[model samples]
Target chain A: MPENTQEGFIDQQKVLDNEEYSIKNTQSIIQKAVDWFRARSMFVLAYGTGCGAIEMPPIFTSRYDIERLGVVGVATPRQADILIVSGYCSYKTLKRVIRSYEQMNEPKYVIGLGSCTINGGMYWDSYNTIKKLDEYLPVDMYINGCMPRPEALIEGFVKLQDNIRNAKSEAGYIQYRENNAFYRANQEKIFGKNTTPTFEENFAGMNQ
Target chain B: MFNFAMTPLGNLFFGLTLIVFASLLLIKNERRDLPLHILLFASLGVIFYASDLITLFVGWEIMSWSSYFIIAKSARIETLQKYIIFNLAAGFALLGAIVLIVAFAGTTLYGEIDFGKVPEALRVPITLLLFVTIAIKSGIMPFHYWVVDTYEESDHIFSAILSAIISKAGIFLFIVIFSQIIGYRYLHGSLFDILAWLGVITSIVATFKAISQEELKRLLAYSSIAQIGYIVTVLALLEGSGIEAGLYHTIIHTLVKLLLFVNIASIIYITGKTKFSQLGNLLYDYPALFILLLIGIIALAGMPPLGGFNSKFLIYTTLLEKKKALLLVAVMFSSASAFLYCYKLIYGIYLGQASGDKEGYRELPMSFYIPQFIAAIILVLLGILPSLGIALFNPILGSLGFEVSSYSSLFELHTAFASFNGGVLMGLFGLVFALILLLVTSMRSKAVKVRDRYDISYCGETPDPQNNLHYGYGMGQELRRISFIRVILENSTATYWEHISKLSGDSSVMVKKLYSLGTQYIGLFILLFFTILLFLGVR
Candidate 1:
């Protein structure tokens, strides 16, 4: 039941309800615009970790033309919105890849781009390679193949774009922010004390 | 005869004055060298004001030696030797040109130079001599070997002046000698065409060289070379607007270098480090300096809403007006590539994760901020009021005998071919910046500040603070992998200079052997001297 309480003969409940509704509407509209732009323009910093990088050129160049979908390759993480981990990450490459990912600005996404990244593929028995890309970086989607074809890569991008627009799932960045300790602990198991700088978040609860 | 004149004082002087004042205020530690800096300033004044080549040369020598002594105060023996050798060579070149002028024209007065009287055979050599002098002093391309070491090894404040003011002496000489004394008619020949090409190649190569440097100040040194290269290319245009455009850029470069070098100096002073790898995440410690550097680089990159863009705009227009399409393309390419070094500079110093020990780091002295703030305000003002720079240069341009550039209005800076309203541009930029900033902030419920400097996103792996994550040293290292850039990096003037040095050393050793007083050697010398004399007599 809705409370029909009045304060000093004024309809305070009605006023509060109206204000909340307006604020919510404004926030939602702004959010929608942000999400639309984020989906429309994606600057990917493609970290070629393994053989999967072989497939990237065909998709980005004249043949597949990723730019047609507003996805462009950038030189640095600072200007990029997407970090495409395009194969198996050795412990060494993982450090640099993570550094690159962290350097990118906010509203960023990660796409695990090959079977090696998904489950180590042929490198499953290897001493150097890591399995399960999401255990390290927050991966929004994974494209499975020994090396994904250009068509498969394009399809993955389209799906990622749709997911971004509809907000179908929790964004990887938010997930990482919420559970960074879990990621940090797993990363520490391999890298030990030599890991990249800690991603610090000052929690209000901690302050109290 | 020495003649001194200082009118049409120009944008260059205006900028020089600002930097001098800023440096004076900024210098707190080096009280003794204040006099030397002042003397350099006075000599530069003489060079700028001189009405004759003799007076200009005198000022140039004084400026060079005073700066040499200041550099020697802190520089290594090798660096000092390189500094003196290159500068002395430049000095002799200027002297040679002046002698040629006096012999040909029979006058030392700048305005009295009758280039028409100079024989066509001699004109090119004289101009070439003067161009060499300018190139060596300004550290243009192949002659730029001395600049990096001297800049890297010098006292930081002096480095600021060396780059900001001393380098401009070359541009001053070029303007006074080539554009005014030699006249455009003689310069329109193949000589000027070669100069234009040299400037283009120098800028392109230096841009890559700057990108490859690991040391912070060395990067700035190479950047200085590249910027001066553009000025050289424009000055080679020998057109009305080209000279004006050069002066405008000269002023902007002066301010930008002063701001950037001082910002680095402050960082160096605090940390006692000059390499990029040694410094990182300073933004948290010195946000103000970071902001100043950002402003400096924004202008240096020639982006709009800053004074740099106005000059760059004028330069492009001047090149376009002359229909130097390919030259324009090359210049544009060089300018476009400059963005990498500029990014590397700011990033190396301030951004990314903290890589160094933060303990014992003190705030930069109040004196350091003085220059940076002044430059920042001026850059912003010039961005909004670009015509102020043009208006400042108008009298100088008028005095130089070029037609004064006309603007559509006080707010719109106009060349013969193009025009832009700086005021409108600034207003639009401000409005858009505000809108975007507001939009970004309102979208967020609250900010998630990083918990620690080390807390960066690593692949599920924790980053050990011990591991170096700052990409400062390696930022542009990949550029060398490009085939064209690879060739450039592989072929350097080091080998050429090394060969010359070796040849000189070997000849000196042989001469020393001849001088050694063995009885047999003395008798042989006497015989050889008599033989040479007998041969001359017989002839």
Candidate 2:
């Protein structure tokens, strides 16, 4: 890769390193205990924006029984802790996906599912689909495949749980909150100024 | 001759009327019928204070006619017709009973007239007549045909009056006539039992009907019927405690209905919408009204830590003391199912997604909040001091010749079976609620208010303004899936009344045939009628 393209990759590594350092330095016994509890319970709101939704039933049901790993599905974004943005994100679908992601309570995480969500997979060159999901929404983990199996999905969940428990990676929610302008700018490039409601002050006339 | 006295029972009802009327007047907007409102108030005073049947009948007639005119201002022609017919029938029944009393006992005075002086043959007819009058007024089953329409069609403020004050007149009549004048000895135990069953059945059926209502006022109208049914059941026991229970329920229901109706009236005033489907997501827009409504419904549902629970507690204890197990069970069933409608009421107007545009809604005037605030404060106070109402009722009970219930303190609501501490219950609940609120607010994870109302998770599909997101109309629709509820919802008293009307129409048509006959036939029929009358008179 040329030096210019590698600069973006290098910057991401630096952000991850800073996150790890901060986690090690600030985590007290109570903080670690809190993180452990948070990791033990996860309420997932599976968006299933595209083809990847078919794999979720087996993981939730008796076949995979993902509940054994302390992961469960919730009905609304308000109660959810993790939002799985599964498969391709068309311009229209991305608007709702952004909306659902914003609705989740804080300390939230987003998991990008399938190669479609990673880089649009087979639809990478399509005008309607976005190539990179992370530019619009901060993706904590990306399970890249045309269609990830139930086993791969569960493995992704376990790894995400480990990352949460150990504070091994930068949380997408925190990055989204801190660098909201960057994400908002990218989203606005496609949806214009009215892109999935602004995070800035006085938005919707809400004081807080 | 007319006689009027402020007896304790009368005083209690008069006080309730004053409170309800005062609150209603505060929020009333239509100023055109002020005189008529005064007439209605004055009539209630007459009915309550009258010591003689003649005076009471005059007051009752004035009340009926004045209310009829008031209803006529806003109601449809059919509604007006139904109102007049029902009130006329009620008036005739009262008149019939009074005429019998005056003829047989030679006096209509409450203290002077003796039921024993009346012939045994006439006593049953008098009791039945009085019962018909009371049953129709109180919206008891079968005779309750006219209530729902009248309540729904009346002016909103007048509807509050109808539910809160006017309906209680029947209850007052019951206490005065059956318990005091005729005396319980003249009434059969089986008759009271039947009455109690009728009350419970009315409550159960009306509750199911309330759940299926689409309009806000219609639901409330049904709810008023159901709540009154409870009072009727408890009062039918004819015990001192039962009367006490009924009175307590009466007071709580008055306050709750006033609060709810006023809150809803304000919403209607601001939004110009009456159907639940048209109103939603108003909690943020009108927090005060929402909280008042919450208090109202919480009490209306007979939940703990509210005035409604205190009354329900007293009623249940009274039933348990009487060992009316089946009636108690039925009452409990109705009370439990009430939670569903209560939830629906709240969810429909406040908690769900907004169903319509919000740009047009304006803030209600300060006058609208006055009644709601007063009612809410009183409800909370009653929850803290359960025996406050009992203490008030004690004098009335004694005056009515029933033994007064004893209570050690205002906070403690004592009964034969059990007693609960209202202060402690309220304090405990307040503490828990406060703690939970504090914890949620101070939590590390903050609530992110969505920027737009349409920003809800819809399986990755954006909800459009045209989409019906509110659960208001659909909340209780699924209750029909249950076989028993299906049966209840499917059958309506309106259908039965319609059938009766059709039957009466057929009978009238057959009678009309006689008028169509030739002059010679008419003359022969008149002669036959005179001959039959002479034969009966001679016998």
Candidate 3:
């Protein structure tokens, strides 16, 4: 009790215990209801960074008809719930991805599409392309394939939806918020100090 | 002798002038035009208070000439030519009408002269001349050729005066000469019908023209023409209720224009950019100005819970009471189409993304806000107490010998066809707005401010600073795709005027050729003219 009351002192054991307890018991009935609704209606802002963009059209259109599951495509990042980073993210592409990811409202998710986004695929040897997308952005799920098929992308979305509905894993946006420094350090390594949208400026008044 | 008396009508107009001129005084400018502005203000007073035709004409001339000089300070040679020509024509028409009135009534004084004594045949010409003068001054279409260019070219601060006060002077003249003095009973019904249609058409065309404009002032210039068009239409109805509605709209429009113009003037003062394409994403930087402009546009659009809606409600109800279905439809159509330009005005300047470097922009002077705040407050007050304007109009209507509209309270605008409670409407809107605001702000999801203006998502590629992202100039370009709009946009009054000028030029050249054919042909022509005159004299 004295340790808990001490200024500038954190009880690691108590904190871990509290974290486990909160994760298991703190989610109220209201939070579960909210998560249920959030999972049902998903607005995806599919940022076409590489070749994986071609698979999205068939799925969104009459062929695959992804809207049957309450998923829809929106125009702007502000309206989106999920951001799809499709295929390889080059150094230049990564900057915009980071900017767009930062702009979206919280409770947002990110799906890394294709092996290119995971390990750069064929562009792994290229100095320009980022090999691992998660190093820069908190990717919630990755569909693995050189160029992921439409079915694989659909599977990845289904898995993500299930995780979201059950609160099975922490959201990517929360992780991005908590561990922003590590991501920013990785970004600044390539873009230098002059990188646009520095963390300090973007998240200035935002609550931790 | 120049005679002046302050009647309720005169007081109403004088009150409007004082409000406009007082607000304009707050604006600081480099141009030493205060004396000219004062002269213009004095002339408006003379016109409003004058009880005699000679005094009225003198005031009218002074008003035109003073504004002419003010406009001339910044206008180009062609604009000056157009201004003087249109105004001179308007002046001549007024002079002709005054001469006719004096000759027919045998007295220049308004009270002494009985319009009933005037010959029936002569009344048509007098009214026609008065209509021409009013049309030119008030910018009724075809005669409206001078309005946009003159407004666009004038000093920004003076444009407020031009739209808010000078144009209303024409409305005053109509109410005085046509409604009160000549009396609508003496006029032909066909003339009022034609005038109503003309006003509605002018508003519709002007609204579309406003939308297609890229420049801010030019858009505002067309919008001014459009708003005045509504007042002119309702006044043409000539009923007591119609005139009441017209007066209410006049007051609302004056406040709205003052607020909007001063707001835009501050934007121009700070950024030195007048075109929509050059302005964007200024919402955060100048939040107060944005809110003021938002109020202005909302009022301008005539939505509920604003002074604009009360006037529009009155106008529609009056039209319904008169059973003017087609005319009301046209008016409503024009009013509906005005939303596009209203949205463009706010969105172009305040919303979207910043068009240029944020470092270059500076804060507007505190003095610039005085007029806007005054106008905005009055607009809100008028919205809360919609019939407050009607209460003010009662004495003026009584003085004009029209039955004054009755109201139970300041909040209730009672009409023959319909009535509404302003307080209830405003309260509901405020409550809903507050609830929605609370709901949005208190949401669990956090709203992240974008890192920068260029932080918008553009697929995967970063937007270059050089790339233009603002939809200000391009917002209305798509309207041209619609067939009816295309028809209206493609046809211009300028072309019609150009054709007339060309026709006159060709006819003059033919006369010049005939004169150059020889002195013999000139002598023969003069002989023929004199012979016709001598024959008429002999008869």
Could you list the CA RMSD of all candidates, in the order they appear?
Answer: 10.3, 3.8, 6.1
Residue ranges of candidate 2 with Cα displaced over 4 Å: A1-30, A46-69, A83-96, A112-133, A142-162, A178-195, A198-208, B359-363, B506-513, B526-539
Candidate 3 DockQ vs. native: 0.31
| Candidate 3: residue pairs that collide | none
Looking at candidate 3 chain A, the ten consecutive residues that score lowest on lDDT are: A17-26
Q: For model 1, how does the per-residue alpha-carbon lDDT over B1-539 read when each residue is reduced to its tens digit?
A: 67886567534573576565555455687534778877877787788788887888898899899988889888899989888999999999889988988898999898888988888788878888888899998988789889989999888877788888888888888887877887887764577878888988998998899899989899999899999999999998888788888998988998899999899989988998888888888887799999999999999999988999999999999999999999999999999999999999999889987676778776677888888888889899899888888787778788878888766566788877878898999999999999999998997534556667665545334577788999998898898789999888778888998899999999999999878769987998899999999999999
Q: In model 2, which residue pairs have backbone atoms overlapping below 3 Å?
A: none
lDDT of 1 by residue, A110-185 (tens): 9999898888898999999998889988998789988788899899989899777766556797777678788878
DockQ of each: 0.19, 0.31, 0.31
What docking class should model 1 receive? incorrect
Q: Better model by DockQ, 1 or 2? A: 2
Interface RMSD of each: 6.4, 4.0, 3.0
- State TM-scores per candidate: 0.75, 0.89, 0.88
| Pairwise lDDT winner, candidates 1 and 2 | 2
